[model samples]
Target chain A: MKYTEEHEWLRIEGDSVVVGITEHAAEQLGDVVFVELPEIEAVVAKGDEVCVIESVKAASDILAPVDGEITEVNEALTDNPGLVNEDPQGDAWFFKMKLDDLSVLDDLMTEDEYKDFLG
Target chain B: MSDTLRRTPLYDLHTELGGKIVPFAGYAMPVQYPMGVMGEHTHTRSHAGLFDVSHMGQVILRGPDAALALERLVPVDVAGLAEGRQRYAMFTNDKGGILDDLMVANRGDHLFLVVNAACKAADIAHMRAHLPELEVREITDRALLALQGPGAEAALNALLPGVADMRFMDVATFDWQGHALWVSRSGYTGEDGYEISVPDAQATAFARALLAQPDVAPIGLGARDSLRLEAGLCLYGHDITEMTSPVMAGLQWAIQKARRAGGAREGGFPGAERILQELADGPLAIRVGLRPEGRAPMREGTVLWDAPEGGRNLGGVTSGGFGPSIGAPIAMGYIPTTSAQPGTRLWGEVRGKRLPVTVCDLPFRPSTYKR
Candidate 1:
């Protein structure tokens, strides 16, 4: 239900957060086969290039939604990258980042809003 | 896009798994997923990567003397090809230009051919016109999936034993959950893997079975391109085209001695005269490997320039990309044969900026396949 203008979503999990690509971003990317995630402990800033997602025609960078430190990465991505395509908002979580400013989420679009924005 | 589209047998599975399907080679195929190509390419190189390649044409050529009949159309020393040995070869026109490249295997009396999906119909027509006596059957009803990577052999062997015994350029008929298929130890990715060509009706079941394996997952065409690029393989339209000859492309090695010494490369096939002369005196332009200076990609059509003053535009990049293996950007293009040497410095014009480039050896990554 949560969303970002960059087409990523953060589903809360206790103190940590699970992030995945938005369905819109996944649809735009076509079929994704490989996902490159940032290493753990890698510090990232808002809008910084944190990771990469590759589709057939183009390889896109997944920008950081907020300045924070990468606490964990989805190791499964190396073996099963198509998970992002399966459930962009669910199983395709790329990494977990502690928010530098939780307020950044407020600037992001909601799931409903993002769906309409595409129109 | 219109819903009036042709779907591969794995269509439903692709949608369920969230594959981003796109039109390619006349079929709606998964180009990428959310994870992307770079990760997928690396994963497949390190592990196993699945690919639905049903779009490629799987054909069977049958006739009283199919080998003799096919020899009139292409050059690959077809007569000497063993029954189960696969060959990477080309179909040439009367003048020696390549019509298309294909994998031809002698399956006993008949020939089993795997061709590019985009050129299937034209290839069939060309073959028919040249060898009318032979019967060509399009097994388009079948679907193919390429399982490539370092761990590919073990993953496939789990389901079908004895499959791992086949070496590169080898093929064998196997039974998959009651469906028979022609599985080849071959792939576009320079990995030890298998290309399973199975009946369409059983493609989904086979795909499901493979997915059940812990190390297996579906890969899209996106990774396929990058991996092949890393392996320095050529794409049909971009690298090898009808306008380009095999000799110029540095594919003269694929031409058998019997064909070249038998006057086949002399002029029998279309453009053979120019091609043979190019082989003798060397081509005016040669296809050479290129590595760019920076992270920015220099894709096809990026013009090449001779370095220093008074330099001329030598050629254009036919294919370029950031290779995960090389950890840098790479490309290939046609340059003056005189300047086509390893370590030769050149320039690649990207958005009008001249980036320093250098000629490297073919293939940015060493192939790990058991060739």
Candidate 2:
């Protein structure tokens, strides 16, 4: 598992990485009311804003962690946005992306480094 | 938080209740508590919620000419208001724009005014400069608290015996344990509620006693805003601005018949020409309630268009948010009178994409005021 400074967490799957917001980010956002997901098979570069998360208070954007094509998105969030607040890192994973080189994840922060960064 | 920011008398109590303090209107006020904005909003709809509104300015206008002098500034019947009743009013600019919205209560020999926190300093200056015959004294030694919801009367009446007898928009002075509490049966949430003005020394204890009841919870500004939005209320700096006239903002009802074109006290306020003309011929642009089609919330500053693809650009949204009680996204914005029909279709441009939105009536939810 790897983390980005923007409070996104990425976990390596078979040939793709699952991206979702961290628990810390979800807590800061309070209650999640709506989520606008990126379309499947959409090509995106690193740092590209692909998703939008709306809370009761404000709206936030989710950026593509690394260069990849979106493979699948969590359709469950469309019916129930509260999943992002309930299980932000687990069942609430936003989308899965196929990266050309999985080794790029090595440059991102680890669990220990992310915890220290939060401090 | 900056050191220059002011603190309300309930600041210590809010911190003690785990409130998340944030800067609002030059004050370090609580935006939400541990209950969160959604929970607090829903709770306020179902039960009583207490809000520390001490940041708002409270002023008293004395002398025999106070009511008549105040009538010159606002387009309302201040002189005709009864002794124990309060009326909603606004300070209009020379260009027919709204300076600020306020509540004026006829407190026997004096008129009690409650203005917005951000506009209080300028409002006091404006009142002093215009109504020189009246003594304008700002009450800085008291704190204002709003207890709003369907359960508000029961909760407040448990502590203060006679609050249940006061009807909506009624104002009275009650004695609670030797404290002269100035209370009004009015609130911004469109619910049966009371706005209690207590001395600073007794505010914390009074709030604590109210919170002791099961139906009362300490709400914050986040819920206060969402509640007012659902009630079709205009926010000070947003919906009603220095550029939006009363008729344009759909606040013509606040202007009584006595202040109209052919009435007894007509044409004395600032910008009376434009306001009276708009009242007769109708405003060019008017404010309307809007509901988005999907779950995505169309927030403030989202531009409106006449068509989805290519059309004329209308005005932007003034106040927009996800209404917890209504269980959907709601908004209010200005648009052309031709397109202000209740069921008219419009498009709100959110993040470069035009989404479907329907023009609805003023309030998204029905007001449950105890009339």
Candidate 3:
């Protein structure tokens, strides 16, 4: 698993990368009440905001970590947004994107690097 | 946190309870504790929640003409207010705009006023400049704390007896550990609770005593806000502002009949011409409760429209968030009188997408005030 400066975690699966916010972001956002995911099969760039997450306090956006096409989105979040707060890194993965170059993941930060960045 | 921000009497206790300190109205106050906003909100609805509202200004108006002098500023009937009773009031500008909303209680010899934190200085100055004959003394030695929710009476009564017997909107003086507490059976959250004015030195101890109760927990500003919104209450800086009139904000109920047209003591207050006219006729725009169809909350400043594509720009949301008690998104905003009816359909633009919203009767939840 890799991390982005925007507090998103990326997990590589075959040619696709699963993306979700880190626990730090979830904790900062308080309880997740609503999630608006990007359309499936939508193309996106690294800096594009692909999702919107609404917590009890405020609304925040989830930016795409790398240039990719959104192949899948977690629909469960629409019915149960609290899942993002409960299992942000696992079952709450927002979307799966198919990237042109999977090697782009190497440029991201490791777990240790993410912790250092947080510090 | 900035060094210039003031700290409340409960600052140490808040830090001890793992409260997330944030800047609010020039004070370093807790937005939420370790329980988080959602838990605190629900807890306050079911149990009792203690809020350190010491940031708000507390003032004592004394002199033989205090009530009459205060009536010159607000639209409410101050002279008609009975002793030991509290009434909601607002300081209106000359143009009928709201300067600040406040709570005024007739405490027999003197009147106690509670104004919003952000509007404290202006409210004080306004009162002093207008009511120069009266004493508008600001009480800095007292800290205001609100104990709200269904279990508030039991928790507060356990420590300070006689609070449970006070009816809603009733004010009384109670003794607690040698401190004279100005207790009022009222609160911002539409709950059966009390707002206690304790001495600054004893504020923390009194709060701790209440927290010791099995039904009491420490709540923060975040929950206080959501709870008030759910109760369909107007936030001073949000739902009502200097640009908004009391009638437009649906606060005409606070204006007493004695202060209206044809009454014995009518039209002596500021903005009386405009306010009385609005009361007799109607406001062009009115504040109404809005509920978004989806789980996504329509926050403040979200624009409203008549159509999803492009129709007419109606108005904007003022106070909005996910109402924990209602289990959905609820909001309050100003819209044209034509579109202000409950059940009227409207659209709020969020992230450039128009989402369906319905104008509903406010308080998404019913109030449980001990009336």
Candidate 4:
């Protein structure tokens, strides 16, 4: 139930947070054809651009959720670009980042708040 | 930015993806996504791609003698067009200028017309105004998706079945989950694929299913442009228009011989006199393909020169880009017929730099047609 103003979503998973583009963003992009992931161990800060997500008509940069270092990249979408368009929330996540500021989550919108913001 | 964009069922989808939407022929369409244009262009050529072309007009022409009447408007041999088959044709002004480019398909009893989204209204209005005796119906609610790439046929065949049987330029009807769809083996991208017309209700689902295929991916307008550019197909407003005759645009093959008969030929269409005259003699200016010496993309309005070193300015570029399939920059333009020969060297002024260019065949890419 976490969100970045950029429309990325995160779910707390004990030591890490699973992140991906929100349903709203996915629906807006029409069909996401490809997701470019950042390299593992890549360092980043809050509001920093790290990755990219491409759709049928356009490509979107994946803004960092919080200051962190990328630990894992989603290799699944390399060959199958449509993975992001099919499941932006569940399977289309570009990568995982190790938080530099663990509580940067405080600034992000919750699922309900983001939904309301969209409304 | 203008509120004039006619939305498709996928409008909301484009907005959420951070699509940089722009007005195109009255539709709010994405020009390029955040990845910029080059990546989007490359992705579509090597892999499968999807496109939302719902803004294009789908029309139905019906009347007692619709086929015979339509033949008068276009040069393609309409009588030979079998049911379920489609052919590209143009509406020429009496003076021979191209009014519009459209696809005329025989959907059993009547003719189904698919016109460019931007020119549809004028095209329809022109039809109703001139052929008052004929019936023209606009099917505005349907949405169109173009699935193009080397893998399109296989991906679609796995989902829709029977659709693979359609060869290049052929068509077939399939029932996807309950909605009837018209799928054709024609596309703007120089790939083996199809352009599908589906009811709005089923368009998204159809797109989803196609995307689910292992090879299918969603492509945007950006890639679509590069693909078409490499293929050397003309875009209506940029390549041909009512002010430009078919002969000048290098579309003489579209005029059927029977339609070319005296009194019935070119001038009878639009600017038929100019078109017929251009055919009898050669056009003063004609569309030609251009190959630049460098990789920079030459764009519309770039001045053309007849000599490599400041030869007299002969014409200008109309559409140009880094063609994905061609693996290089390509351009199209109207140049003097005297300089239209392949290998004829020309110069394109890009950003004040006169880039050396060569006149090539109309299609920079070898057109792979099932015919």
Best by lDDT: 2
List residue ranges in candidate 2 displaced over 4 A: none
Question: Residue B247, candidate 1: how far off, in angstroms?
Answer: 0.9
- For candidate 1, lDDT tens digit of each residue in A29-109? 755545678989998887898887765455688888777889999878766666877777776789998765666666777
Residues B114-135, candidate 4: write the lDDT tens digits: 9998788888998898778888
Better candidate number, 3 or 4, judged by TM-score: 3
Question: Ten-residue segment with the worst summed lDDT in candidate 4 chain A?
Answer: A51-60
lDDT of 3 by residue, B1-371 (tens): 79999999999999999999999999999999989999999999999999999999999999987898899999999999999999999999999999999999999999999999999999999998998998999999999999999999999998889899999999999999888999999999898999999999999999999999999999999999999999999999889998999999999999998899988788888788999999999999999999999888999999999998889999999999899889999999999998888988999999898999999987788899888
Q: Write the per-residue lDDT of candidate 2 for residues A1-119, one digit (tens) a residue.
A: 89999999999998799999999999999999999999999999999999999999999999999999999999999999999999999999999999999888989999999999999
Each candidate's number of clashing pairs is 22, 0, 0, 31
Q: Candidate 1: misplaced stretches above 4 Å?
A: A1-56, A59-115, B262-267, B308-310
**Predicted candidate 1 versus true structure: per-residue lDDT over B139-172, tens digit per residue:** 8689989999888888899889988899898988
Can you list each candidate's DockQ? Answer: 0.12, 0.95, 0.95, 0.05
Q: What TM value does chain B of candidate 3 have? A: 0.99
lDDT tens readout by residue for model 2, B65-131: 7899999999999999999999999999999999999999999999999999999999999999999
Q: List where candidate 4 sits over 4 angstroms from the true fold.
A: A1-119, B1-4, B16-18, B33-36, B262-268, B308-310
For model 3, what is the error of residue B14's alpha carbon versus the real structure, in angstroms, after optimal superposition? 0.5
Displacement of residue B11 (Cα, Å) in model 1 is 1.0
Error of 3 at A29 (Å): 0.2
Local lDDT at B287 for model 2? 95
Which window of ten consecutive residues has the lowest lDDT sum in model 1 chain A?
A27-36
